[model samples]
Target chain A: MTVSDIQKLLNAKVLSCNEKLNMEVTNAFASDMMSDCLAFAKDANVLITGLCNPQVMRTAELLDIECIIFIKGKEPTDSMITLAQNNGICVLMSEYCMFETAGILFKTGEIGGATVGC
Target chain B: MAADNTIKLHYDVPNDDFTRAGEASSDLKGKLKQMGISPDAIRKVSIALYEGEINMVIHANGGYIDAEISENGLKLVLCDTGPGINDIVQATQAGFSTALEQTRMLGFGAGMGLPNMLQNTDDMIIDSIVGVGTTITMFIKM
Candidate 1:
């Protein structure tokens, strides 16, 4: 699905990256732990996270992720938004909790990309 | 390829600050890119080193990272004065973290830092003296 599709599905506003709405993303990773995201996430373009910090953007930057969907009704701070804007990363907000948000995305056919070998 | 020209960058890890973690790795990533290093190599080194940086801040109470850039690859030497690991085998085990509740609330201490570093890098060496400190060296081929 695309960022536009997620926006419509969750009734989330396009806080940024309106231009890249058509970009297709095959998978999604939802985690509060930035290290886990960095360690295992590969080829997933959308990050569903509840953590509101600059390191979120930095982690997304390292993975080259294009979209960040903030779950748990959490809105990023102005500084966080500015960082996302500067990084050209699309930002969105969902009222769903992390688990619910992930469930919705997974039910909608966005499967987990790959598991980090234990 | 030709003879390697070494470029070393040192960063003093500040354990008091959780918000400032990963600064060194980000800076190193930018430097490697500016030097025209390949993207694949940069990604490997960035992820591996960033994990180490985060670990140092979380567990070691601060430390130092020395990144050596060369034609062959990027080599990172991370040393920390924090209480050393008591059991290397157990520490390397996933989900075995001693980070406090606050650190986990901040979305860290999942116990994947070391294993993740090992997974991302081509070579990894860890040496530790309990109660003294720990040293980790990792290399990613360019």
Candidate 2:
């Protein structure tokens, strides 16, 4: 599915880098820990994270995550938005919590992106 | 410049600027992309190096990051003079951290930094002296 589709399914608002809305994303990885994302994440197209911080954007840059969905109604800071724009990573905000968002995405066809363990 | 076909880059990590902690890693990431390195290698090196960069800012005040990109692999050396770790083994264990609450709130200090570095790279060596400082060297085959 395209990032735009995920945004529509979750009713998420685009927080930054609107240019990538049409980018296709086949898998999503959810994590609050950047280390887990770093160590085990392989080619995860979308990152569903509860943590809202600059490091999340940094993690996205390293893993080449095309899109980031901030769950639990979290909003991106101005710097985070700038970072996302500069790196060409799309940022989205969802009102649903991490569990609900992951469930919705998984039920909708997004597979588990990363491996099971670190 | 030192050896055949090896591109070397260095950056002085600033201690006072937490926001700029990962600049060196980011710069190196961009350089690797420009050089047409494999995406998998670039991702591993970038993430592993960034974790070390963050560790330097949070624990060691600041440090120096040296990146040597050779034809076969990438070498990263991060050196810091801050108070060194007491136990190297314990520090590498998951979920063991000595970082302040402020650092954790910023999405770090979970004690997975070293482990993450080790996992991403092909080889990693960490040397520390309790009263002196610490230096970590890592290599990733491209």
Candidate 3:
């Protein structure tokens, strides 16, 4: 799927780096814990997270994640947007909660494999 | 390549500053990318070193990172002057975290830092002294 597909499916608003919407993403990982996201989210290009912080963008950079979808209507700050822009990461905001967003994406077969306990 | 060909990068991690935690790792990743390192090796080094950098901020109150990159691979040395880990065995466990509740609020401290570092690096060594400091050496061979 593409970032545009995810944005439309989740009814998300593109907050930053809109130029990246055409990027392809084959997998999704949802987590509020950055540590777990870093530990187990292997090869997942889209992170569905409720955490809105600059570190979220940093995590995306380290993992080579192209997009970050903030769930539960959480808005990212300007610094977060700037960080995403600098890192070439797309930031999206979804009004749906994490569970609903994950379920929606999972049903679409976009969500990746289950991450085992580390 | 010879040892003289190695590129050495150093960073001073600030204490209790969650916002600035990953800057060093980000800079290092860009440097490696510019050097045309393999993507897989760059990914491994980034994740491992980023985790170590976060650990330094959240647990050690601050630290220093020295990364040496060469044709063979990357070597990272992270040293912090803070409360040392009392149990290396337990600390290496996946769900073991000594972070305070405040740190957890920042969406970290899930106890996956050290284990994740170990998972991404080819070799890692931890040296610590109670009430003194901890030094972690990690290497990822190309």
Per-prediction RMSD in angstroms?
Answer: 2.5, 1.8, 1.7
Best candidate (score: TM-score) = 3
- Docking class for model 2 is medium
Model 3 spans with C-alpha error above 4 angstroms? A114-118
Cα deviation of A75 in candidate 2 (Å)? 1.4
Compose the digit string of candidate 2's lDDT tens values, residues A6-116. Answer: 999999999888888998888778988887787667768789999998889988887888899999999988998999899999999999999999999999765555654
Error of 2 at A54 (Å): 1.1
lDDT of candidate 1 over B1-142, digit per residue (tens): 4445578789998986777787888788888889888887778887888888888988888899998877777888999998999998888888888889887787878888888888889999999999899999898988
lDDT digits (tens) for residues B38-121 of candidate 2: 888888888899999999999998989888888769989999999999999999998899999888777788888998888889
> Higher-lDDT candidate among 1 and 2?
2
RMSD versus native structure for model 2: 1.8
* C-alpha lDDT of residue A11 in model 1: 82
RMSD of 3: 1.7
Candidate 3, B56-125: lDDT as tens digits: 9988899999988878788899999989989999999999998888878888888889999999999999
Q: Which residues of candidate 2, in runs, are more than 4 Å off?
A: A116-118, B1-4
C-alpha DockQ for predicted model 2: 0.62
Candidate 1, clashing residue pairs?
Answer: none
Q: Model 3: DockQ against the native?
A: 0.86
| Clash count of each predicted structure | 0, 0, 0
Give the number of the best model, judged by lDDT: 3
Residue lDDT tens for model 3, A1-118 = 7899889998899998888899888878889899888878877888989888888999998988889999989999998899989889999999999999989888987556536452
